[model samples]
Target chain A: MDVLRITFLRIVYSALLLAAVVVLNFVMIHLAPGDVADTIAQSMGGADAEILAQIRADYGLDQPFIVQLGQYIWKVLHFDLGSSYYYNRPVTELILERLPATLLLVITAQTLALVIGVVTGVFSARRPNGFLSHLVTIVAFFGHAAPVFWTGILLLIAFSLQIHWFPVGGMRDVTVTGGFWAHSFDVARHMVLPVFTLSTTFLALYSRLCRASMMETLGSDYVRTAKAKGLPMRSVVYKHALKNALSPVITLAGLQFSAVISGAVLVETVFSWPGLGTLAFQVIVARDTPTILGILFFSALIVIAGNLLTDLVQRLVDPRVRTGQ
Target chain B: MSFLLKVENLRIELRMRAGVAPVIDDLSFELAHGESISFVGESGCGKSMTALAIMGLLPEGIGRVASGKIWFDGEDLVAASPARLRHIRGNKIGMIFQEPMTSLNPVYSVGEQIAEVLREHQGLSRKAAWAEAIELLDAVRIPNPETRATAYPFEMSGGQRQRVMIAIALACKPKILIADEPTTALDVTVQAQIFDLLRDLRRQTGTSLIMITHDMGAVAEMAERMIVMYAGRKAEEGPVDKVIAHARHPYTQGLISCVPHLVAHLTEERQDLNEVPGIVPGLAEFGQGRCLFASRCARATERCLTTRPEEIAFSDVHRSACWHAEGM
Candidate 1:
């Protein structure tokens, strides 16, 4: 009963938060310089004032700020993200079309980063001053220092230009004629560089964080007690210390999930992957107000869902949290 | 008779940024089968470190047994391989620490933590271990063993947590249990309850105990033999009643006087704390040839500064390491 109540409250809270997020994104984008009318006029080779006014009127940009924001919120509540100014299609339809690729890329990259980071972190933590530990630290330093785009370009140069082991860009081969398996293989090949590029920074963060957390937890009194219990060192570390150490890492991962989505913009643009990140980049450049707002709203929902999942996982793993203490 | 556990000239050194230093200077003691002993000392006197060293759980790359022969059941623990030591640690020897709150992994329930030991050492099936865990909880005097079994460490009070720790330590029914100031972090009333529980458990199981504490009152109640430690060295060792009644070392004498309830006169009348005057010397000053307690000793003589005193026997079981022992 309590769990049901708390979950219901959480959903209601998320709904309210989403509404606020929509309003905030609308206000911030309005405050930024340039509007869809200006971009449209510029695209039409510099329109006169009459044409600019007509474009503004056509897109409802000429309406009062409060009236526009009210209408937008009402439409959002009705599941109608206004049609894209550039694409002339429903903003939701465009985002939906691109959502799957982004989800696949983000989820894959995150899982890869988390798994590699935690494994290496646990390995490094076992012998903190060992050669392998130092190597992990050095690699994490390099991962954090390099920019995502630079890493992407470097992987492109190495894997595509020099060796031709994988495709240069995009998600799948246009020339591929086979069915699902071939298409998937082609997509997977194309994804290797982009996923690696996007996940490097997160991987670096998780590994370093997990290492530090593991070291501290290993020193905790309970770990010592576990050792005193004559538990083999393996159980003493992995079973006793790792769970406590992971809570913080999981929390950071959840917070960073949104950043990963934003980070996808650079990776997607670099690799020309057909994801929301590419759509977002194009929409920003085109000043497609409805599409931009739609993307932000969806990203907010994804991040909120990610946080909820993290909380649920933490509750499952940590009894303290399970008991709501 | 062969002793159940014995330590001969045990020395523990701590590696620090500056250099290595002896934290536990040449120390020796013995625990007979089912014999309860207490190591009483102020902080940094190597009481807990001795326990850690015995369990082979010293701070990694920091605290190491410099030289020692910790003989347990005819096996020299210092020479024991890591695997051998690990086998002996929770099977033959159990340990509980001071901070009950932090000493338990918060993620696991009290029952699970207890079950873990049974599973690890006894190789009990998961269901069997879990059943044994609830029984252990009940044995430790925790109320509602069934429901409380699923309760996490945070849900329990400090006393209850300590009881859980005790349950975990005693789960495998090890030959010896090392309790390093187990009750220090609990409330005064809770402290007495925990001690009662320990005494009852020890009596039922006949498990020898090595209690490390500074509370003289607790020492008198919980231990038959007490070794008062000063600066990582045994300052006095004897029957608790004899030593507390006729304390030859100034440090031990001061410690006993500090406990108001133990001193009948002080319990009736309010007074300022009867505390030992100086602090336990730091690691840098340890292992010096001179008496580490000299600076703080009220009866220190010139000889105390030049050479450390050796253990001088007052009786068959009572001993003190002070140049002024004879006079005292």
Candidate 2:
């Protein structure tokens, strides 16, 4: 029952957040210096006045701002995102085609970062004065401070150029057919560099978060009580301490998912992974309003959904949260 | 007569920023089979540390047993291997801590937490352990054991949580139970209820108990014998009634006098309550050569500052560590 309520609330929150994103997108596009007609004309080496007017009428760009926004929202409710002017495809179709690559990259990277970060954090916290703890802290500090692009470039240079181990750029080798296994393997291989680069920062951030949370949990009287009960050191650290510590980390992981998806724009461009980042980049350069707005709506949905999932997990793990406010 | 637990010259040295010194110096006591002993002292007097040392659960980097022998059921716990210690802990010697609110894991249901000890120590099946958990909870007099068993620590009140802690400690029916300030965080009403429950449990199971606290009232209520500690050393030891009625050590006298007595009618002359004049001396400040509480001693003399007072016996059962003990 509590799980149901949590899911219901998440859906409502997602809907409200999505509505706000749509409104912001409309305001941004409308407030810009030029309309889609003008942008198209500029791209096509300047269209005549008649052609511009015709294009304006065709796309309903001649309507008032409020009327256009209302119509756009209504169309979105009916699952119609309109067609991309440059791509000459439905906006939803365009988003769908690129989303898998982005999803594949971000999810893999985030999962890897969470696992490695949490484990390292737990170990570091357990043996606080050990050599490994010092080493982890030092690495994590640099990983968090360094830029993703710089790290990506350095990794590319080392793994792709210097050592000649992995491919220099792109999701896959040219010779590999885009079959399920072949494409996935190619993507996975190419993902190592960019994902590793992106995850270095995430790893650092999460480890720091985990360490702080773990320390607080360790200091909690219950942990001391558990120790007093004479439970083995392993059980005390992992079962009693780590479980409580991960609650905040879980929440952070959910919030970070959205940030990672959004932040991947820069990293994706660097590695040329053909994800939403590249698509968004192209749409921005071409000033393609539909495609850009579509990606914004989609990303906003992902953020809302991620947060909702986090809430559900929290409820499951912690009964107090569910029973309380 | 077999002794369930014994501590002989148990000196626990804490390495602080200043230097190393004994937190529990030459503290010796024994809990005979089914006997209940209470260690009473003010805060930071090392009562809790003594309990932790017996359980072998001292916090990291704070303290170590400098020199001691903790014998539990013929086994030297201080010298036991980690693997051997694991077998003894929770299985043979269970412990309940103070602050019931924080003693149980917040994430898990109370039943699951109790059952975990059963499964870990006794190797009970999940179903059997859970059944036993509810039964133990019922034994602790927790209402609606079946339903409350599923409740998390946060859902339960302070009293209920303490009961659950008691349930967990007794899950394996260990020979000895160590309760460190078990009811200190509770209210007066709840404190009485918990004390009653502990007494009832002791009667039913005949398990030896070592209750550590700063409350002399609790000692009077529950303990058969009591040990009073000052500056990490035993100041007085005797039957609980004798220690309360005729405290030999000045520190013990001060502690007993501080407790408000109804017999002393409220008057203007009694307005000022009895209070110890000084704080506990820093372990580093008092070296191994001299008495630890000499500076704070109202009866201290030249000899008191230079020489550590050895335990002087008033009787075979009652003893005190003080040069002025005879005069007192």
Candidate 3:
């Protein structure tokens, strides 16, 4: 009953946050120096002044600010996000087409990073001063400190270019038409580098967070009590210490999820992957207001959902946090 | 052979960057089967460290048994392997710490916490452990064991949590129990209740207890034998009544007199409080040549400054580590 109420409250909070983000995003896009009119005419190789004015009015850009804002909000409420200025297609359809690809990369990368981070984290905590622990810390330190692009480019050069172990770019070979499994296998193979680059950087963050959190929990009074109970070291660390340590790690995961969405834009652009990240980059360059706002709206939901998941998970794992005590 | 636990010339050192400092220096004691012993002293006097050393729960990379023999169940614990030590720790010797709040994992239900020990040490199945846990909670006199079983640590009061801690500690029915100031964090009324519960449990189980506290009232009531610790060394040790009535060391006498006696008249002017004036020296001064308590001892002489005092036997059961022991 308590958890249910808290979760309901969180949903309400997330809705409010989403509403605020939407309004802010809409206002900021309008307040920027240029608009879709300029980019549209620029692509048309400098249209006549009268034609530029016609295009601006055609897209409702000439409406009063409040009128435009109301129309946009009402359109969104009716699930009819406006068409992309660049693609000249409905924004929803375009985003839906690209959503799965980005999710595939982000989810697969996030899952891989989180699992390895948590595992190596607990392992390093178990043997804090050992050679394995030391090696993990040093590597994670450099991995985290280095730029994500630097890490991606390095892996591309070494693994893809040098050894020729994986493909260089794109989801799969465009010409190689195949069955479901065959297509998925090809995509999975292509995923090796981008996913590796994405996962390793955050894997470093998770490991460091896990190690530090685990170390702190390891010194807790309950851990001492567990030891005095004659529990084996494995039970002491895993059953007793890991749950407490994972609390902070879970919160970090939420921040990482939203952070990774934006991060993916850069990596996707580099890899030429056909995902929402790539879509976001292209739309932003074209000053395509509808498509960009639609992407921002989706990103905001993902972040809100990520935060809600962690809050629920944290409450589930720790009764103290759940009861609000 | 009649003794359940024995320690001889035990020395524990904290390895510091500058030098090794002995926290417990050349301490020796013994506990007969089903007997209760108490170590009473001010904070940082190494009473708790001795408890940790015996339980093999000393902080890693910091504290180590420099030299000692903790003999229990025909095994020298100081020389015991990690595997052997694990076997001995919870199965034969149980320990409860000072604070009840932090001593329990807040995430676990109190019943689950108790059942955990039984499952680990006794190899009881989960169902049996849960049933036995409720029974143990009942034994500790916790009200409504069934409902309280599912309650988390935050749900319980201070005395109740300590009862849960004791329930966990005593679940395996170990031959010995080490309670490090188990009631210090509780209120005075709760303290009495916990003490009573401990006495009742000990009587029923016949488990030898090693109570570490600075509370003289607890020592006088619950302990049969008491060791007075001063600056990490035993100042005077004897039967509890003997030490309280005829304390040979000035530090011990000061500690005893400092507590306001209840028998004094309510109308009479309160006696000026007695205090042993200096502080317990830091780790750097541990195991030094002079008497560690000499600066605060009313009986201190020039000899007390230069030469460390050896144990002076008053009887087979009583002894004092003070140069002017007989005169006092």
Candidate 4:
């Protein structure tokens, strides 16, 4: 019951914040030096003043700022995010179409990174002074410090250009036809380079964080107790130490979900994956107000939703946290 | 007499950057079936290290048992294979640690933790292990055993957690139990309760116990025989009451005097609480001279500093290591 209340409160708070941000975005764009009128005038090769006025009225650009914002908010509340001027489709439809591709890439990459990172971290922590641990530390340092775009380019050069292992860019081959499986496989195939690129940075960070947390937990008294009980070293590391270590990792992963999506914008645009990231970039460049606002709202929702899910997962993993909440 | 555990000439050395001698030298002791003995010492006297070495759970890359023979039930534990050692630990030799709050895995339920030991040692099914876990919890006198078993370690109080630890250690009814300051962190009442529980357990199962502690009160209450350690070497050993009443070793005398007695007249002239003067010598560059305690001993002489005192027998059961043992 309390959880329901908290969730409801969070939703309301997020809605108000997102509404404020959208209004601020509208105000900032209006205050910019150029306008849609000027852009249309330049594109039309010195159109007459009367024709320009007609074009502005037709696009509702001549409306008062308050009237424009109120109409946008009402449409948004009614689940109608208006048609995109550039894409020639509803903004919602465009975003929805690209959502699946981005979700597939981000979710798969995050899951893979978490699994591999956590396992390596636990192992490294258990053998702090071992060669494997030192090697992992060095690799993680490089992975964290290196730029994601640079890493992506390097992987592209190595895997695509040299080995000819994967496609260089884009979501899928134009020839792939029919059904869900084929589309998914095609999308996944094209996702290889970009996912790997985005995951490298997160993988390094998660591993380093897990290793540090695990190392600290391994020195804790419970670990000693487990050892004293004569549990096998494997059990001690995985069952005892790893569980506690994951709490911090969960928090980091939650925060990183937002970062991953934001970072994905650059990667998606570079790779041309047709995800929200690419749509967002294109929409912002075109200054298509509805499309830009739709993407902003969705990004905010993803971040807030990701954190909420993390909270729920943490509650499941640790009962003490549930009671505290 | 048949002994269940015997540790002979156990020497632990710190692997120093520069050359250094062993930290724990020629330590020897034996535990007969159902007997409880304690190794009492000041902090950093290598008491806990001795326990860790026995358990084969020493910290990585620092200390090693240079030479020793740890015999458990005719088996040489020091030379035992890792697999064999794993079987012996928690099965034949259960151990309870000092801090109960940190000693239990917070993620697992108390019952699950206890069941882990049962499943590991007894090869019981999870269901059977859990059933045994509840019984063990009940034996430990924890209220609402069923509910408490489902609770995490962090949800319980310190004393309750310690009780749960004891319950888990005794789950398999191991032949020997090593309790390293098991009740040190508890209040007086809780300490007495734990001691009583241990005593009851010993009486019921004839489980031999090796308790490591610096508390004289704990020693007097629980152990039948006591080995007084200073600077990682045995300074005295005897029946607990006899040793407490008439300590031959000067260090033992100082420790006994330091124990606050209820008799006001007996403690009215107490002066040596802080007067023991020097701190325990560091393991690095420690002397191999006549007496490890000679530097702190008020009765030290040229002979004390020149030649190490041998273990001298006061009786068949009482022994002291001091040059002036006869006079003292």
Q: What TM-score fits each model?
A: 0.94, 0.96, 0.96, 0.95
Task: Answer with 1 or 2, whichever has the higher lDDT.
Answer: 1
Which parts of model 1 are misplaced by more than 4 Å?
A30-65, B261-274
Off by over 4 Å in 3: A175-179
Q: Per-residue CA lDDT of candidate 4, range B60-143, in tens?
A: 678888898999899888898888888878888889999997898878999999999889888899999999999999999999
Candidate order, DockQ descending: 1, 3, 4, 2
Please list the residue runs of candidate 4 whose C-alpha ends up more than 4 Å from where it truly belongs after superposition: A1-21, A27-33, A46-52, A176-184, B18-21, B263-275
lDDT, candidates in the order shown: 0.91, 0.86, 0.90, 0.86
> Residue B240, candidate 2: how far off, in angstroms?
1.6
Best by DockQ: 1
Report the lDDT tens digits of candidate 3 across residue range A134-171: 98899898878887788888888898899998888899
Estimate the overall C-alpha local distance difference test score of candidate 1.
0.91
Write down the C-alpha DockQ for each prediction.
0.83, 0.68, 0.82, 0.75
* Colliding pairs, model 2: none
Lowest lDDT 10-mer window, candidate 2 chain B? B263-272
Candidate 1, CAPRI quality class derived from DockQ: high
What's the distance in Å from true for residue A113, model 3? 2.6
How many angstroms is residue B314 displaced in model 4 relative to the true structure, after the best TM-score fit? 1.5
Per-residue lDDT of A134 in model 2: 89
A83-165 per-residue lDDT for model 4 (tens digits): 88777799899999988878877887888889889988988987888887898889888988988778888888899889988
Error of 1 at A186 (Å): 1.2
